[model samples]
Each structure stands twice: as structure tokens, then as C-alpha cells.
Target: MENSVIKFHHCEKDIYCFFVPEQCPVCGESLSSRRLQEAPVSIPSPFVNGQKIKCSFLVKPTKGTFLREYDGRSDLHVGITNTKGVVYNYNETGVCRDEQGWAQSVSVPLVQPDMYSLINQWDPYLEQFSLAEMWNPQRYNETDHNCYTYALTFINCVLATQGKRNLTKTEFTEKFVLPRTKKASRYITLYQEISENYFYIVDSSQQEDDNSSI
Candidate 1:
């Protein structure tokens, strides 16, 4: 990412690989210094003690990451956060996923920070989970019984306390997880190409007619 170049696709229309070009790649519009940079990105606050971001489930790479801004398959680890931003994730050995290492984690905001803090029962339910299936490490299986199961179980527990219906894996993944991951994957691939070439361009018209995830 030298000079941090990333190609800017203009709203799924034409290709615009303006490395500060003199004119706009489309419409033959003139370029200005300020507009050429696009808009600057605002970084969010850190996850620690950030109730809004951490009140829901969080996902990060299982091991050291690379541009893994997010992805929820085998390479990713999921966790639930307390109102105070303490993450509780499960693994084969134990439930201290954070004790390992993480560069960054993207959170899913299914659970609300205010809702969790408003209930006096929330903390108790979290503590009680320690006595559940995770109590026996032998039950751990990377594919079947894993961190995702633990997090989803806690979500259902909270729903029960709130008198809401349970959520299935299909709905949770297709509705929530995939949307966020697509954005991350697109960002990563775009960056990878730009880092090498210092510029990238895409034209929707040039692409084949097909359905594909980022």
C-alpha cells in the first residue's frame, strides 16, 4: 500500500484509475486536487470499552491476520462481548480467544449495548454459560461444535430472556454475516491489487453476466 493507492470504482459503472490524473476518467470532467483524493475515511474508536461496537458478537482471524478486515469461515473466530467489551470466545483448549493475539475485529451489531446493560439478568446469564456444554472441553469439534455454536447459544439465551424467537444458523449467516464479509473481501482484494500496481480499475460493463460474491 505504498502511497496507499486503492482503485475507486465509480458506482459500478466505469473504470476510474486516477492516480491523480489531470482529468476525470469518465464524463471528461476536469480533476481538482481535493476531489482527486475522494473522501477521507474516518476511523472508529477502538473496541475496548466501546459498548456500541462490542455489545454484539465480534469476529476476527483465528490466527495472525492479513487484510482480514473480516471473514467468518474457518479462518475467523467469533465471540460475544459483555457490556464492558470483554470478549468471550471458545476454542478446543478453552474460552480465552482474546488471550491469543488480534490486530483488529469487526463486530456484528445484532445485540444492542443499551439493551444488555438495561437488564439486570444479562450478566448472570453470561456467567451461567460457564456451566453449560463448554464446561467439557471434550465436546469441542472444529467443524461441528465450535466457537460459533457457543456464541449462537448465548444469543438464543438472551432472546429467551427477552421472550423473542430463536435464530437459526442459516438466517444468522445469510442475513448478517455475508453482507459484512462481502464488503471486507472487496476491500482486501482491491487493496492487494493496488499495493502491487499502485492503481486499479474496474468496469462493470466489461464483466461477464453472472452472479458472484465479491
Candidate 2:
């Protein structure tokens, strides 16, 4: 499959292409080389041991009228990704409605070095919290139980592991509220602040200082 080549159909023209697999292993859909074409990509398995892992907070836009008109937000989805590059979010399957659709729109990396360690440590806790419901489509709710809440919960877990304070509901709203709402400016500002504070790489010296103090 790795050596196979694919030809793209673009504007009624066939173009030679290479590198990508001929078909998706999971969905068995034909792969296309066209820039506009969307196809599913495989997610690599998670690392088995406590190796260095990077997690990113992601936001994906929604195209549904019900989502936009009713929710009043273009930022429809939120999720997290590890170094293996698999996104974990709460949403319906095929939410993107495209072959290659997954949270590819916007992303911000977590700042802490022990992010993966915390994830491994919190596995049992998450399970008890009904982590399986995250994958259940029927359990999704727009207000009380949504992708935003899922992401915020995960972030809070990570923060707890670091001895950091948890974000309140109001604070979470201010930081990640839908951009189309009346608090657009405040949302933008708080989003920038959280992104910069929680997503950037920490200095080695600072990290050492933190660890030593702890």
C-alpha cells in the first residue's frame, strides 16, 4: 500500500500523483491526490510506555445550519491530540462529513511537560467519569454535555495533576466561548491569554525550578 500510486481527478482532468496510499486501510476508500479532495488518514497507535508525548487543543468549525443558527458559533468542535496524532473528541462519527475531516482547522499545544504522564495517571478516573460516553453519539448534548465540556474536563484533569487551579465555568466560557456571540472581543482576548499561557513551551530552567520546588 505504501508503494502504490494514485491518480487524481481534477476539473475533468486526470493528474498523476504519488506518495499517499492507494486506499484507506480503515474505510477502504480510494485515496486521491487532488488538493481539494478529502480522505481519511490513519491514526497511529498510542505510545505504550511513558515516553515524551505532546497534546494539542484543537477547534474545528461546523457547517450545519442547526449548529450555526442555533448555537451561534462557528467554533463547533473541540478535542485533543497526542504525539501519535490521533484526535479524541466528543462528536458524532463523520462529523466533518468528509473523508479526511478531523480537527484539522485550528490547534494549540499543551504547555506542561508532564501532560502525557497526567493522562496515563488519570485513565482510571476518566473511566469512572464515564469516558466511554464521549464516544457514544446518543450521549451528546449541546449545553450541559458537549465537546467544549469534554475538553474543559480533560484540561482540568491535567491542571489538577500539576497542582494548578481548575477553571470555573465562567472562566472556561470566557476563554473558549463561541466567537459569534456578543462577547466576541472578550472571548478573543481570553483565548489568546490561555493559548499563550498554557500552550507554549516552558523554559528548561523554569521547569527544573518548578520540579525542585514541588
* Candidate achieving the largest TM-score: 1
- In model 2, the number of clashes is 1
For each candidate, the alpha-carbon lDDT, in order, equals: 0.59, 0.46
What local lDDT score does residue 35 receive in model 1, on the 0 to 100 scale? 52
Model 1's alpha-carbon lDDT is 0.59
Q: Which stretches of candidate 2 lie over 4 Å from their true place?
A: 1-53, 64-75, 92-100, 113-130, 133-135, 173-214
TM-score of model 1 (CA atoms): 0.68
Q: Which tens-of-lDDT digit does each residue in 91-210 have in candidate 1?
A: 887665253343355567755546635354555567678567554688889998898988888888778877899999888878877777666656556555655554455555554354
In Å, residue 164's CA in model 1 sits off its true spot by: 1.1
TM-score of each: 0.68, 0.42
Q: Tell me how many residue pairs clash in candidate 1.
A: 0
